[model samples]
Target: MPRFAGKTHTAGHIFFYEEMVVIGAIFGTIFSVFYPFFQFYKWIGNSPVWETVYIILGQLFLCLYGFFAGIFVGCLALAIAEMLNSIPIFARRTKFRHGIGVVILFMALGKSVGSFIYFLKQLFVCGGM
Candidate 1:
Protein backbone atom coordinates (compact mmCIF):
# COMPACT_ATOMS: atom_id res chain seq x y z
CA MET A 1 0.00 0.00 0.00
CA PRO A 2 0.97 3.60 -0.53
CA ARG A 3 2.54 5.49 2.41
CA PHE A 4 1.47 8.97 1.45
CA ALA A 5 -2.10 9.98 0.84
CA GLY A 6 -3.96 13.05 -0.55
CA LYS A 7 -2.95 15.46 -3.30
CA THR A 8 -0.04 17.78 -3.65
CA HIS A 9 -0.06 21.12 -5.47
CA THR A 10 3.15 22.79 -4.38
CA ALA A 11 6.50 22.46 -2.76
CA GLY A 12 6.51 21.96 1.05
CA HIS A 13 3.10 20.35 0.60
CA ILE A 14 4.33 16.81 0.96
CA PHE A 15 4.05 15.27 4.38
CA PHE A 16 4.44 11.95 6.10
CA TYR A 17 0.79 12.33 7.08
CA GLU A 18 0.28 10.24 10.24
CA GLU A 19 3.20 8.02 9.49
CA MET A 20 5.81 10.35 10.96
CA VAL A 21 4.24 10.08 14.42
CA VAL A 22 4.55 6.33 14.51
CA ILE A 23 7.98 6.44 13.01
CA GLY A 24 9.06 9.10 15.49
CA ALA A 25 7.84 7.04 18.43
CA ILE A 26 9.80 4.04 17.26
CA PHE A 27 12.86 6.21 16.81
CA GLY A 28 12.35 7.76 20.22
CA THR A 29 12.36 4.36 21.88
CA ILE A 30 15.52 3.54 19.99
CA PHE A 31 16.88 6.90 21.08
CA SER A 32 16.08 6.13 24.70
CA VAL A 33 18.14 2.99 24.54
CA PHE A 34 21.15 5.01 23.47
CA TYR A 35 20.56 7.98 25.76
CA PRO A 36 23.49 8.25 28.16
CA PHE A 37 21.91 9.42 31.35
CA PHE A 38 21.06 6.70 33.86
CA GLN A 39 18.74 8.84 35.91
CA PHE A 40 17.15 5.93 37.71
CA TYR A 41 20.24 3.87 38.34
CA LYS A 42 21.00 5.36 41.74
CA TRP A 43 17.41 5.04 42.79
CA ILE A 44 17.27 1.43 41.71
CA GLY A 45 20.61 0.49 43.23
CA ASN A 46 20.45 -2.52 45.53
CA SER A 47 16.88 -1.64 46.26
CA PRO A 48 14.11 -3.75 47.70
CA VAL A 49 12.45 -5.91 45.10
CA TRP A 50 9.33 -3.73 44.99
CA GLU A 51 11.42 -0.61 44.57
CA THR A 52 13.15 -2.19 41.63
CA VAL A 53 9.83 -2.69 39.96
CA TYR A 54 8.89 0.90 40.65
CA ILE A 55 12.17 2.12 39.28
CA ILE A 56 11.72 0.07 36.15
CA LEU A 57 8.26 1.49 35.69
CA GLY A 58 9.58 4.97 36.20
CA GLN A 59 12.22 4.45 33.58
CA LEU A 60 9.60 3.16 31.18
CA PHE A 61 7.52 6.25 31.83
CA LEU A 62 10.47 8.51 31.15
CA CYS A 63 11.13 6.66 27.90
CA LEU A 64 7.54 7.21 26.88
CA TYR A 65 7.87 10.88 27.70
CA GLY A 66 10.98 11.09 25.59
CA PHE A 67 9.18 9.37 22.75
CA PHE A 68 6.31 11.85 22.71
CA ALA A 69 8.65 14.76 23.18
CA GLY A 70 10.67 13.64 20.18
CA ILE A 71 7.56 13.53 18.02
CA PHE A 72 6.44 16.95 19.20
CA VAL A 73 9.79 18.54 18.55
CA GLY A 74 10.17 16.85 15.15
CA CYS A 75 6.73 17.99 14.01
CA LEU A 76 7.43 21.50 15.23
CA ALA A 77 10.73 21.62 13.39
CA LEU A 78 9.12 20.29 10.23
CA ALA A 79 6.43 22.95 10.40
CA ILE A 80 9.09 25.63 10.82
CA ALA A 81 11.06 24.22 7.89
CA GLU A 82 7.95 24.16 5.75
CA MET A 83 7.32 27.80 6.56
CA LEU A 84 10.85 28.67 5.55
CA ASN A 85 10.41 26.73 2.33
CA SER A 86 7.27 28.73 1.59
CA ILE A 87 9.22 31.95 1.28
CA PRO A 88 9.04 33.33 -2.25
CA ILE A 89 12.69 32.77 -3.10
CA PHE A 90 12.59 29.16 -2.03
CA ALA A 91 9.11 28.52 -3.37
CA ARG A 92 10.03 29.79 -6.80
CA ARG A 93 13.10 27.60 -7.10
CA THR A 94 12.48 24.66 -9.43
CA LYS A 95 14.96 22.51 -7.55
CA PHE A 96 13.00 23.03 -4.35
CA ARG A 97 10.16 21.01 -5.77
CA HIS A 98 12.27 18.77 -7.94
CA GLY A 99 14.53 17.84 -5.07
CA ILE A 100 11.97 16.87 -2.50
CA GLY A 101 14.50 14.44 -1.11
CA VAL A 102 16.77 17.37 -0.35
CA VAL A 103 14.00 19.03 1.57
CA ILE A 104 13.60 15.91 3.66
CA LEU A 105 17.33 15.79 4.20
CA PHE A 106 17.47 19.37 5.42
CA MET A 107 14.43 18.90 7.63
CA ALA A 108 15.91 15.80 9.24
CA LEU A 109 19.24 17.52 9.70
CA GLY A 110 17.59 20.52 11.26
CA LYS A 111 15.65 18.30 13.64
CA SER A 112 18.76 16.40 14.64
CA VAL A 113 20.73 19.55 15.35
CA GLY A 114 17.89 21.09 17.28
CA SER A 115 17.42 17.94 19.33
CA PHE A 116 21.12 17.76 20.15
CA ILE A 117 21.19 21.32 21.33
CA TYR A 118 18.15 20.66 23.44
CA PHE A 119 19.68 17.57 24.95
CA LEU A 120 22.88 19.38 25.84
CA LYS A 121 21.02 22.29 27.34
CA GLN A 122 18.92 19.96 29.42
CA LEU A 123 21.96 18.08 30.60
CA PHE A 124 23.67 21.27 31.59
CA VAL A 125 20.66 22.67 33.33
CA CYS A 126 20.06 19.45 35.21
CA GLY A 127 23.76 19.27 36.11
CA GLY A 128 23.77 15.75 34.85
CA MET A 129 25.96 14.49 32.10
Candidate 2:
Protein backbone atom coordinates (compact mmCIF):
# COMPACT_ATOMS: atom_id res chain seq x y z
CA MET A 1 0.00 0.00 0.00
CA PRO A 2 1.07 3.60 -0.51
CA ARG A 3 2.61 5.27 2.54
CA PHE A 4 0.12 8.13 2.75
CA ALA A 5 -2.82 6.05 1.59
CA GLY A 6 -3.06 4.48 5.02
CA LYS A 7 -2.74 7.79 6.89
CA THR A 8 0.40 7.46 8.85
CA HIS A 9 0.36 11.06 10.02
CA THR A 10 -0.43 14.64 9.02
CA ALA A 11 -4.02 13.60 8.31
CA GLY A 12 -5.42 16.02 10.83
CA HIS A 13 -3.55 18.98 9.41
CA ILE A 14 -4.66 18.07 5.92
CA PHE A 15 -8.29 17.84 6.97
CA PHE A 16 -8.15 21.09 8.93
CA TYR A 17 -6.62 22.98 6.02
CA GLU A 18 -9.18 21.59 3.59
CA GLU A 19 -12.07 22.56 5.84
CA MET A 20 -10.78 26.10 6.29
CA VAL A 21 -10.35 26.63 2.57
CA VAL A 22 -13.81 25.33 1.79
CA ILE A 23 -15.45 27.49 4.44
CA GLY A 24 -13.60 30.62 3.38
CA ALA A 25 -14.53 30.11 -0.25
CA ILE A 26 -18.20 29.59 0.58
CA PHE A 27 -18.49 32.63 2.87
CA GLY A 28 -16.56 34.90 0.54
CA THR A 29 -18.57 33.91 -2.52
CA ILE A 30 -21.85 34.24 -0.69
CA PHE A 31 -20.91 37.63 0.68
CA SER A 32 -19.82 39.10 -2.63
CA VAL A 33 -22.32 37.47 -4.98
CA PHE A 34 -25.50 36.04 -3.50
CA TYR A 35 -26.17 38.80 -0.96
CA PRO A 36 -26.24 41.56 -3.55
CA PHE A 37 -28.03 39.41 -6.10
CA PHE A 38 -30.87 38.65 -3.72
CA GLN A 39 -31.15 42.25 -2.55
CA PHE A 40 -31.42 43.56 -6.12
CA TYR A 41 -33.46 40.67 -7.45
CA LYS A 42 -36.12 41.44 -4.88
CA TRP A 43 -36.65 44.81 -6.55
CA ILE A 44 -35.99 43.83 -10.16
CA GLY A 45 -37.72 40.46 -10.27
CA ASN A 46 -36.49 37.65 -12.56
CA SER A 47 -37.71 38.74 -16.01
CA PRO A 48 -35.01 40.96 -17.44
CA VAL A 49 -31.99 40.05 -19.51
CA TRP A 50 -30.14 42.76 -17.67
CA GLU A 51 -30.64 40.81 -14.46
CA THR A 52 -29.05 37.82 -16.09
CA VAL A 53 -26.22 39.94 -17.26
CA TYR A 54 -25.76 41.38 -13.82
CA ILE A 55 -25.60 37.94 -12.23
CA ILE A 56 -23.12 36.66 -14.78
CA LEU A 57 -20.93 39.67 -14.28
CA GLY A 58 -21.35 39.46 -10.54
CA GLN A 59 -20.33 35.83 -10.49
CA LEU A 60 -17.21 36.60 -12.45
CA PHE A 61 -16.26 39.20 -9.87
CA LEU A 62 -17.36 37.05 -6.98
CA CYS A 63 -15.42 34.03 -8.12
CA LEU A 64 -12.16 35.89 -8.29
CA TYR A 65 -12.86 37.79 -5.10
CA GLY A 66 -13.94 34.66 -3.30
CA PHE A 67 -10.93 32.70 -4.48
CA PHE A 68 -8.54 35.29 -3.11
CA ALA A 69 -10.56 35.91 0.03
CA GLY A 70 -10.45 32.25 0.84
CA ILE A 71 -6.75 32.07 0.29
CA PHE A 72 -6.12 35.17 2.40
CA VAL A 73 -8.23 34.01 5.31
CA GLY A 74 -6.68 30.57 5.22
CA CYS A 75 -3.23 32.06 5.19
CA LEU A 76 -4.07 34.33 8.12
CA ALA A 77 -5.34 31.43 10.15
CA LEU A 78 -2.26 29.42 9.34
CA ALA A 79 -0.10 32.29 10.50
CA ILE A 80 -1.99 32.51 13.76
CA ALA A 81 -1.65 28.78 14.20
CA GLU A 82 2.06 28.97 13.69
CA MET A 83 2.33 31.77 16.20
CA LEU A 84 0.35 29.81 18.74
CA ASN A 85 2.35 26.67 18.11
CA SER A 86 5.53 28.53 18.94
CA ILE A 87 4.32 29.40 22.42
CA PRO A 88 5.71 27.06 25.06
CA ILE A 89 2.37 26.84 26.85
CA PHE A 90 0.74 25.25 23.80
CA ALA A 91 3.63 23.14 22.65
CA ARG A 92 2.33 19.94 24.17
CA ARG A 93 -0.85 19.77 22.14
CA THR A 94 -0.63 19.15 18.42
CA LYS A 95 -4.16 20.29 17.72
CA PHE A 96 -3.99 23.57 19.59
CA ARG A 97 -3.33 25.49 16.43
CA HIS A 98 -6.35 24.00 14.77
CA GLY A 99 -8.44 24.76 17.82
CA ILE A 100 -7.43 28.39 17.84
CA GLY A 101 -8.17 28.65 14.13
CA VAL A 102 -11.58 27.12 14.64
CA VAL A 103 -12.38 29.51 17.47
CA ILE A 104 -11.48 32.50 15.35
CA LEU A 105 -13.58 31.14 12.51
CA PHE A 106 -16.57 30.60 14.78
CA MET A 107 -16.35 34.11 16.16
CA ALA A 108 -16.37 35.54 12.66
CA LEU A 109 -19.22 33.26 11.62
CA GLY A 110 -21.25 34.24 14.65
CA LYS A 111 -20.87 37.93 13.88
CA SER A 112 -21.94 37.35 10.30
CA VAL A 113 -24.98 35.40 11.42
CA GLY A 114 -25.99 38.22 13.71
CA SER A 115 -25.84 40.66 10.83
CA PHE A 116 -27.85 38.34 8.62
CA ILE A 117 -30.49 37.96 11.28
CA TYR A 118 -30.76 41.68 11.62
CA PHE A 119 -31.09 42.08 7.89
CA LEU A 120 -33.88 39.54 7.75
CA LYS A 121 -35.71 41.19 10.61
CA GLN A 122 -35.52 44.54 8.92
CA LEU A 123 -36.58 43.16 5.56
CA PHE A 124 -39.53 41.22 6.84
CA VAL A 125 -40.78 43.22 9.82
CA CYS A 126 -40.34 46.66 8.33
CA GLY A 127 -42.07 45.59 5.13
CA GLY A 128 -39.25 46.08 2.69
CA MET A 129 -40.02 47.27 -0.81
Backbone clashes, candidate 1: 0
In order, candidate lDDTs are 0.67, 0.69
Across 25-119, the per-residue lDDT of candidate 2 in tens digits comes to: 79868876667666766686687797888889999989997998896788678676766556545534554544665765686799799879878
TM-score, prediction 1:
0.33
The TM-score values for the models, in the order shown, are 0.33, 0.33
Q: After superposition, how far is residue 106 of candidate 1 from its true place, in Å?
A: 17
* Tens-place lDDT digits, model 1, residues 1-129: 021233233334345545665787788687677666545555557558868787789899999989978967886777776677675466466545466657767977998998898786797566465
User: What shift in Å separates residue 69 of candidate 2 from its native position after superposition?
Assistant: 2.2
RMSD of each: 11.5, 12.8
